[model samples]
Target: MSKKINEKIQSIIKQCESLSNDDIESLPNYKKFKVFYSKKSHKTCDIYLLCAFIFGLLAIFTTSISYIGIEHVLYYSYDRIFSINIYHEECLAPKLETLIDIFRPITSCDICQHIDHIERISNITREEFEEKYAYTNHPVIITDAMNDWLALENFNYEFFKRIYRTNSSALRGVEDNCQFFPYKNKDEFETLGDVFNMDFDRAHMIDDDYKPWYVGWSNCDYSTAYLLRQYYSRPYFLPERSESSKLDWIFMGTPGFGAHMHIDNVDLPSWQAQVRGRKQWTLRPAPECFHICKELTFIVEPGEIIILNTNVWYHKTSVVSEDEISITIGSEFD
Candidate 1:
């Protein structure tokens, strides 16, 4: 609604005009332009008439499309590191570092700080976040994995013991092994297992009492569901009302288990943070490196965060804890 954004929409419309019909059609809301014709002036002006008619039809069609699309769309001119401050017209990465430092102590919760960087770097207020960044349809960069170590050192292991005493199903964490709590949905769990190239038997092994080195639970909405398990991590925004902002939360079940390389749903970004134990993260840019990245994996330490522009590249992790609890935070962006 701001004048600056209005100009941006106009600029995008101009850019769209230069694109080919095929390209325009590939975008959402432009299918109407593929058809529809307008009236012409003179009978003798056949060629000129058709040109004028089509232009008029396209002009009206594109204008309406632009108006609607800009409401929920964001167009970035750069790739990978988008570190500029479009709002203040200044570089924000440095300020982001300052915020990280300031919140360093308070944010150290064993539930872990996943994607704290994205939250810290996001200087937008809750209102502005709702109005602008939420709807931009851009990937949010979650970072600062290293912040978790602070929380890990402060956690009271005896408190966790109290939880285990009351709830036997509550699994104790191991430092080296990846462990997870399984969900009730078998089919959805299997589907997620397939994404990780695991068979149902191998995946379901987490349900066994043998206590493997690592474990993780999978279901239709594991990420979202996991967040719900904790009372403090309620979502602040939804996709329909406002633009999608990042959803960040701590994952403090066990250690060792990690995600595999894969693209996110059509419009999402993500970052993983480590609060306790350790994880190795391998990152590859979305360029010529895509294929190699898909085949490789990485390890990250307790204090590290992996920034995943889920829209662009693939990543996988390896757990590094020996026999201690591991806590992590996962963040998603729109």
Candidate 2:
């Protein structure tokens, strides 16, 4: 390689290592990998080095994400020669094309109760919902009907966030409260039961900060056959089902202050509803979008919900207030 190219490659690698938090968040995710090769001179080196670097990066993405358990591997530019096995389950080119389809708007369901609408029925429109329930400056004034019908007290703000940091499917903690049983049938359940030989109720309970987080599928039977058999104590949340057949739920809590940016591996749809406090969400679509949407964040009020596909996008939340409680639920679909 030429001297100039060597200097450039070294510079790029140094910059990649020195990337600031803002710099990382600002750049489109796809371009992030390119930071490895950005300073290199295109003329000096043949494509072989680039291919080698890309392969190395792919190996890194796979290994790193396995530890983080993040499934999405975003790329800025595609190269046929250097790329390894397809990072995603679907074909590479088609995956990018299908992003829009996965994130389409969430429609209202007749059977499942919509807790958000109750905030509106009190003569508050969707437009005014945020301002009225604004968690920062204002208090969430609840009507008697809302308090009673929705079982508002069923939620304990303090307890929920405590559970979230430990119980969430997103975390990579020692306690296996959130286990991944991928089989889509009854046999999978039996296999899981036989291999772990766990009591469904007891197996998922983990001591986090001296408390425990319970785990089970919404569809799983708690009353009948016991896998992790312990007395069921946590709140039972039944997330809305999809038009297909996938089952999932949203996990939101009072993130009191700063939360980190991350993605999930499970192929599911999710949304965050501002239940009690204010939350600012910074979200970026898949591939090369950090360049396009430099200022792509929206603050959510107490009642409104924001739809997000965790599989394809990366998002962060800001608290901006003390003792503020926010609730965001994830919606999973088939």
Candidate 3:
């Protein structure tokens, strides 16, 4: 075996030395290997290239399986086992639960002390907030922030119905442009009125035995946007004259039903104000933050504002009381 290996090495060396100096220089780590193998071994190089090609093909195949097929299998399997429709097209991404379980031994770290409670402030200056929290990607709840907003006093189901439903002309462009997301239901509503008219009371009663049913939609219509501005002013904590898109979102539902765990795909941070009832929010750091920080959970009462880096955290919200309907209005900002 020793003699045979020596003969093979000698053959490789001779083959390696036959290549031009320029060609040899082009090869990675060529100078180091040139001391022993002075010739190019086309067979050996072909074998390595073949192995890389196979690996590349395998990577593409695996990704296709994961993205196109695995989600469907997992979705149907989960639905069959639980007898519930918990899967949504928006949530087809690989779950953090699975990733955590697989990588916990390697990724787990000390729970960050700051994760215990989001910073609570009553009268923080915009400069102070932007300096401490906004730029740092920290989450905070500003208590007594929207105390004077008319939305706190007049914004409710009836208020919206009176404003938008009464004037069909105002909703002409917006009624069909927005998409409605229903809690665990696949039904799609074409307009805001259709969503408001959902059998929420009955759904709330039935949700006692099943997962909670919630619904939400974005306020993208020009008339609806104008209507919302009449009741709610921008929170005092946000920077004055900050540029933000006119698109805002409204979430309304009873307790036990709300948004599921997911990160926002927005370009900037966001603030959500609880205009009615109360909401409990459970926020987890993005998978990248797992090694440095732990999850944070808290509640936002009516009239309170929560400013958070929704783009960096996986968060979900649920109403605190079943009796009182929950209404929250949120918008993104720079």
Question: Residue 106 in model 2: shift from native, Å?
Answer: 24
**Which should have the higher lDDT, number 1 or number 3?**
3
Query: What's the TM-score of each model vs. the native?
Result: 0.32, 0.33, 0.62
Q: What is the lDDT of residue 241 in candidate 3?
A: 61
Model 1 agreement with the true structure over 1-334: per-residue lDDT tens digits: 6999999999999997899968866888665543433223244478888899999988875776688564222222111144322332223343343343334332112111121222333233456544644444222332332332434455333433333333233321221122232222222322222223344333234444423233343212344334333522323332344332333334433345554543433345544556567765554433344333233344556645544545444445555665555556555545
Question: What TM-score does structure 1 among the candidates reach?
Answer: 0.32
* Clash number for each model: 32, 14, 7
When superposed on Cα atoms, how far off is each prediction in RMSD?
23.5, 19.9, 13.1
For this target, which candidate reaches the highest TM-score against the unseen true structure?
3
lDDT of 2: 0.39
Off by over 4 Å in 3: 1-114, 164-172, 188-191, 199-212
What lDDT does candidate 3 reach at residue 276? 87
Worst lDDT run of 10 residues, candidate 3, spans 104-113
Candidate 1, superposed: residue stretches over 4 Å from native: 1-150, 153-210, 213-246, 249-256, 284-297
lDDT of 1 at 192: 21
lDDT of 3 at 270: 82
Kindly indicate the candidate among 1 and 2 with the higher lDDT.
1
